[model samples]
Target: MDVWEKCRSWTASQLQETGQDCYYQVISDTFDGTEVTFADRRIVMAASHDYLGLSADQRVREAAMAAVRRFGTSLGGSRAISGSLRLHEQLEEQLAQFLGQESAAVLPSGYQANLMLAPLLDKDDYVFSDLSNHASLDEVIRLGEAKERKFLHSNMKHLEELLTTTRAGAGKTILSDGIFSVEGDICDLPALTQLAGRHSAYVVLDSSHDLGVLGPKGAGAAEHYGVQPLLITSALSKSLASVGGVIAGPAEVIRYLRFHARTSLFTAAASPANVAAALAALEILQTEPERRQRVLNLAERLHNGLRALGYDTGASTTPVVPVLVRGRERCLRMWRKLCEAGVFTAPMTYPGVRAGREVLRVTLTAAHTDTQLERLLNAFEAVGLAEGVLPEAGPPREYAPVRITRPTMATSTARGEEP
Candidate 1:
């Protein structure tokens, strides 16, 4: 407790001195799909996870409105109590079918879905997880009190060694993210499944960022690899452009979780609007294949452009492109510069990635136009060269280049200097 208190104080004081928020804080006055307004300024929205841009779609909006008119706002209780609605049932059925699973259960959020499912494994069972898995998955493994081992991020050799050393007859479960949120690297599901088969382990995949963004029909990594995991969990907030979490798996497992998972049994059912919006999003995902391709194409262009500018975008083949910056100071400065350039992106520093591997996490979406992409690239080039992260684009122009500064507590007040 004393250490935690000191740590909290240290972080707060450091951020105060540096004029940094714990995470980048943007007070957006308005946002559609392509751009977000921060008070009087509009920034091209390159930091959003709304991959398919269905969040602002008229059809999805209309579906939510209709559901609200019919069912009011919420179901008013947990599903175990009075909260279960036909909409919830309908969404689950749709999800199960979409993922090619036997059944599905929708939860309040993606975090809760992992939280509820992870503890179902017995305390004596052995669980193996990737070090880079979502925090919720790690939390639930702790909650379950199961004997768990964490392998190095995506290191199959380390995983294999751990699997070999586990108690011979103990139940084994493998936990991993389908698409790592920060770095945007994909899980090698085919390789993971092969390893799971050898060890007889049940694989739990968090497809939160993959569904509606991968595979021929957007069924996610499982379909992309032509393999299925024992359990698949995802959030409806990302590509679905709605809100809620869902787990799709065997009917028996879902039935057991329906009653036993505390998060599901205690939390209120998903609101009418969210459920209906998710249903509509799912429909759009199937019908509008172009949305998926558009985002991917934009992502490729962004990735190629960043690499051309000589920025380190670690292992990403997805919409989540991370421009790696070396230290905290440079990373923060880079973020501030990009913000000044009217482009918004998320910055990852200590405890998110390793100490020195800070990155500016840029997310791409289908709604971004070619002109917007060009603007983004130009901003990156300007900032990258200014920060000495990239070489000069041309052979040294004679004119003076403008200087940008990351605001500190002492520098924050007078001119509305952005951090």
Candidate 2:
């Protein structure tokens, strides 16, 4: 009956004691986009979110260092108060233009970027969201206290059916993740926006995993679909190699959110170094479009290689590849084996994904060379074969999504093992 009661059961002591903990607060000695040194060993990294691999770039490092010198690291206040820098203004303006939006408001993180949408929803508003949309969108609706209706993942027919329940005059909003991180599938943005238009509902697209990674110009899902959403929110941490988030839309709409959204007005502004890092990364993203293409090509290669080896990589067309694993225990065992084989990948369970829908999260970045990628595939094959994740001694075989059979290993879902 105490406040600390719940946290008592959240400990990972059992997993650690049993040596079943493959990842949870594990220390990394050093990470340079593609390689991560940890546990006294250097391994090829396939778990980083830095999709364009700009984090370790000397140019990005220099930009961050220069900003630290100029702005003294922290700004100490919210952007609306004493924290707004000329650099912040420049970044916002440049981002808006790059994304083909009228204006942008920067936030401390992508989580806050989505939470700020709370102010846009009202009690009477009907919030239609995809089942697999990022957790932040769900929290925003809860905070907004709107009528929530979750349709199946990327199923527009279900979305339209829900829209039919609401009147045209109702205050309705459609929420979705441009790229669903768990399964590595792009959203049905074209169908979503069209449905919203018919119902006169506003659309909010969370492109946290899509920005600087998808679209013709890398402007994200909306740009790829040739349709415009009422607003787009994304993280700068991934492709931009920085630690913050941004929401872009029409000028007046952005201005309204800037003033009304407490998530932005109350939170301390993003650090100067982080903002500068994102701005510099953005510049590189635009000037060197080849990096974008290279990363996608590397991802498709990895995806094809895994599928050819008879693993189920569900409907992925992007760099985020989720190799669906079976049980929590077996998943950790496979991860440990891959580590022994000199590779590192992320482990996702329960809250990170659905309880039964566990996976070993593998990511591809432009920083990874073809040699390193091949090494990763070799490691996966070895661990997968040893773990009975794939058919033994089979001539390189291809498996369809539904055809791949996932074998469940007996065990537990460790505490705090969230993606």
lDDT of 1 by residue, 1-419 (tens): 57688766777678755536636575666466778885468888888889998888999999999999999988889889885888899999999988878899998899988987755679789899998888888888987867989999999999999999998788888899988988788888777877888887888899998898877778777776667888899999999888899999889999998888888888999888999999999999999989988888888878777776677677887888888887888888888788889888787777677777788999878878999999999999899889888866652323222121111122111211111
Off by more than 4 A, model 2: 13-23, 399-419
Model 1 weakest lDDT span, ten residues long: 410-419
* Cα distance off (Å), candidate 1, residue 386: 1.1
lDDT of 1 at 284: 95
Clashes of each: 0, 0
Give the per-residue lDDT digits (tens) of candidate 2, residues 181-239: 88888898767877887888888888988888776667777776666788889989899
RMSD of each: 10.8, 8.1
